[model samples]
Target chain A: EIARAAAALLRKVKGPVGPLAGRKVLITAGPTHEPIDPVRYIANRSSGKQGYAIAAAAAAAGAEVTLVSGPVSLADPDGVTVVRVESAREMLTAVEAALPADVAIMAAAVADWRMAEDAAQKIKKDGSGKPPTLQFAENPDILATLGHHAALRPRLLVGFAAETQNVLDNAASKLTRKNADWIVANDVSPATGIMGGDRNTVHLVSRDGVEDWPDLAKGEVATRLVERIAFALGARDA
Target chain B: EIARAAAALLRKVKGPVGPLAGRKVLITAGPTHEPIDPVRYIANRSSGKQGYAIAAAAAAAGAEVTLVSGPVSLADPDGVTVVRVESAREMLTAVEAALPADVAIMAAAVADWRMAEDAAQKIKKDGSGKPPTLQFAENPDILATLGHHAALRPRLLVGFAAETQNVLDNAASKLTRKNADWIVANDVSPATGIMGGDRNTVHLVSRDGVEDWPDLAKGEVATRLVERIAFALGARDA
Candidate 1:
């Protein structure tokens, strides 16, 4: 335990060598599993690849990063603190707790709805073939919550819009609705192979305009996004 | 292609050594993903560990094994013909295709219901606070289908009953309702940690009576089950 503390202290005291050296970056990633019962759940197809890559890039660039992740088969990125959560509500709570950041990226594909009332026991099929009617409850929107925070809101908030149709228009609207500085939008239609695939083709939507980006590896997209963030921050300071 | 064919021929010609050498066993394992949309799905907590273990054990006993599996991260077991599938309907189709076996085990946690009509586009959240009303359609009962198959019904049919309450009673009812010879029943309450855990404590519910099993590793359970299967088959032949 002592040695572990010393290692953490060393990391805290490491030299300020990168553009984001003093920045605290908070990121959310993966698909939240909303319980319908003790055995079954509702889930999305986000693989957490892009968000994990971004976290790794931020850490490499000397940022103090906190990643609020949902259920995913992924290892924690090096030099970043990761808080694992299961449901959208839990992810929101974790994201709120890691507040007062320089930048916050809401990259997780959060479930839009959860069971109105999760059953304690597994629901069995009655002899009759009639199916159950599932009543859904809207899940807490993590990005909007952070955007509307009275205080401790990140200076530059980013949100992701994964859409099956009208990707750019949906992303542009999301930027205004969520009060985010930028909305990284992508076509996640099944045919695109983007939901769980490593390669991503994203468009940057902001107040200025939309910039269409070519297809690239998730890691490359992270690197490019980080560079743009640094430039944007430097311009604002100037 | 020639090398592969030669390898297959060699396996086919290998001396009949183990007790199950001349037998053919059919198994189904894992959780079916019932799609709600292109991005979201309904899933269960089954990790497919127990069923995969049984497949491996059966193959080791020299049975010609065919395993129909749902979405799982496990690698295919050595010498087993694995058929991968996604939804409950698809799984039923695959199981029907690989029929006429000496023994059949239905271990998959198939979805009880799926969307009545899957959305072609990603469902958008309207301004209203009210969530969508999901209409479910009952999925096919793979175990019951096999049990009622007139011509291709296996000599020994095994089903699994994963219950959070009334473990024994549920198993017994399932045996009668599904026309299964045995039901490997287990309590999968979150507290039990058996759904995704490496260990299991299962009860064998048969016509004779319920046999309580001690907590054992999944692999050990598979081994013992295979031994019982061999003995039962031998006794029947005698």
Candidate 2:
């Protein structure tokens, strides 16, 4: 028994002992900036707190984590390999490069549109009262692309849906449309203060059913989610 | 001699000492966010570092500083009253409310335009590949409005022009058009690393001519600018 206890302590001390040992976890975080010019861009209100917490939790679980993050003020999580990018296209490239993982979590709030013809110089006022019309182009859907990548797609794919209305319905639809195994949905209404807040109340939507989670600190949510992921992967292996 | 030394020490320790003692200075900093929807907004690359440094310097120089700042990650400077705003219109209102100052420095990268009618909800991508056309409306010119305010126009009005090209020419034209006493211009090209970098090489433009400042840390620039403002105010008084 003493020998077994010593071995367990050694396992905890050394690398790759947890349930996620030897597994690869890939995650995307932050808001993608879609440039309109050299100086300006369009961005969302994602603070990247939840995703960063999840990354940290995964790394703590002894997973070989690769995080593809956009421009965020967050520091790199301990024991995680981070690849930083600015725009959605760059993020997609980075994510693709870090793929072939056991789990892929799409948590970044990717911009849907970008300037079709970004101005070379600052767009100046022509002294006319009228403002210039802006032309936008649709950005590549990163989650959908990963979901459709049959050969290299992660064994368990997760996506996030931040909606103001019909949160569960939107999340369920997203799960099917994106071919993701689970959708973490949250109401990001301005009144909710969830976009940049530390605490979140997320609902887990899967093919089986929806699990409404209580309001919890983002770190707690991450820990619970990571635990669930380990169980799911164990079941899959069994 | 002992009494004189004691008086000097007291002055140094007391409130409102230095060149700008008993002066009121109003400054604006950071980039304004123009909302397109609840989730996304257009923003510039202004880090608010330069402006925040200036506010700190002004406060250290014994000026009663009112800093009208936009959304920035920076903490409020010591002894400075900071009014936080998000959009250009809100910034204008805040600046106007903190008016009738001895000096005004417009350093914020205020958006020239905002959405004509921002959406109440997050915009979703349709099945079509095309993106929706966006309409913009011009924002109020805070600097120009203050310059044109004859009754409460500051004794020394300053503005900043962050340009990628035609830096000097744009600054010179802006000095005259905005009726500002000086224009602090800098090349914010990505190559220069000035937009969000610590070091800056700025040119001070005025009716007299341009003064090319050496590349200096942002804090040093702020100190020098505050000294110049004090000198200018003294000269005006003389």
Candidate 3:
């Protein structure tokens, strides 16, 4: 009986595990809503699908996953611990809290510009026919910050670039400027229906070279991305 | 009066003109369905957005656009021609009839598999309750055929891939296999929400190398793509 118990325990321990076993992965998703007023704010159509999928994929690959998501309606994926935030500052704080991950994927559609000063209350449309002149400011580049961290940075830091013209040239510039390991570039023109669609087509840009892929369902992309992450991690460990 | 008439003639002769010039581009969107019976057929949720958007973007960029789509009922983008179809064979014919374009982009989600023999009538349920077996055959690769013509291929050949793992590695393989100039790759696990949602993240792969981009609105992506295409064409001419 004792021997049988020991064998069962060993089997449990030796079972096939995911590639990300013992690894930690951090992901950020959705668009931060910068409050312009108590009832209104600036936001985009980021649904947090890609980020959530990455977190789920990492977890399935046997990693400890932390998902820092913006104000999205999606439920937390199974096997992932989710931290929710509304503003860019809050998202940064949440990301900092989920530190020391093996990989950090910044898939969030962060707003580059925000209101200079959020109004405490909604401003009424005055009889003055002129439109209101609102001041704006630049938001921190989260991907750059995380990617260029001298210490406590993840082994792999990935960023995204959404471009229209000079796609490759601009993406290359961003990759070098941001110090990211990889950058996924795509043409999200309103005509592509990628902003909130179930299918997507993208390009992968790395220091080595550029690789293009066929259009695919989103689910398939996540599974593939997780597998690649695993292989990349394995190579790094070796 | 004679001098003015001569000047007008010269201006008319010098004006830029091409087969695709000022003509609307109409595209068939997404994969097709070839039914075997009332309840059975082969289908994929391709979400007609990519091709449809291309049509719209092309139109927006100055070409008149028409979209002969499948069953998807997405709102007709402003200023486009839309025709709906149901089968690959139908799509092919539609495409042929719509040709003589200045530029045609084949971005539809074409099926690569179809029922070997579609039954004219529905098969009745058997007394044994055994499910009817399905036999499938390979469907045509529409993009390759249309984009690889010795004389009729589009000026630009673009293909899409929804890969689950080793995306770039596999994308590189497909680029050669398909004899295409560009491939768009997307990681499409269920979590990516790229198929039915409002936002997308993607990568652009090509021969030169990889270039990654940040996430942006789909409309922005389209506008940028049009701008890039224009720039590329201008550079080619120069």
TM-score against truth, every candidate: 0.95, 0.95, 0.48
Off by over 4 Å in 2: A1-15, B1-15
* Superior candidate under DockQ, 1 versus 3: 1
Give the Cα lDDT of each candidate.
Answer: 0.92, 0.93, 0.68
Q: Considering every candidate listed, which one attains the maximal DockQ?
A: 1
Q: Candidate 3 falls in which docking quality class?
A: incorrect
Q: Give residue A79's lDDT in candidate 3 (0 to 100).
A: 82
Candidate 1 Cα RMSD after full superposition onto the native fold (Å): 4.4
Residues B112-163, model 3: lDDT tens digits:
5556787654343343434455565665666666666676665555566654
Consecutive 10-residue window with the lowest summed lDDT within model 1 chain B: B8-17
Q: For candidate 1, write residues B1-238 as lDDT tens digits.
A: 9986775676668854477888999999999999988999999999999999999999988899999999999999998999999999999999999988999989899999999998888888988998988889999999988899999989999999999999999999999999999999999999999999999999999999999999999999999999999999999999
Which is the better candidate, 2 or 3, if ranked by TM-score? Answer: 2
Q: List the candidate 3 regions with Cα displacement exceeding 4 Å.
A: A1-16, B1-238
Scored by lDDT, model 3 comes in at 0.68
Q: Model 2, range B70-90, lDDT digits (tens) per residue?
A: 998999999999999999999
Each model's DockQ score: 0.83, 0.80, 0.01
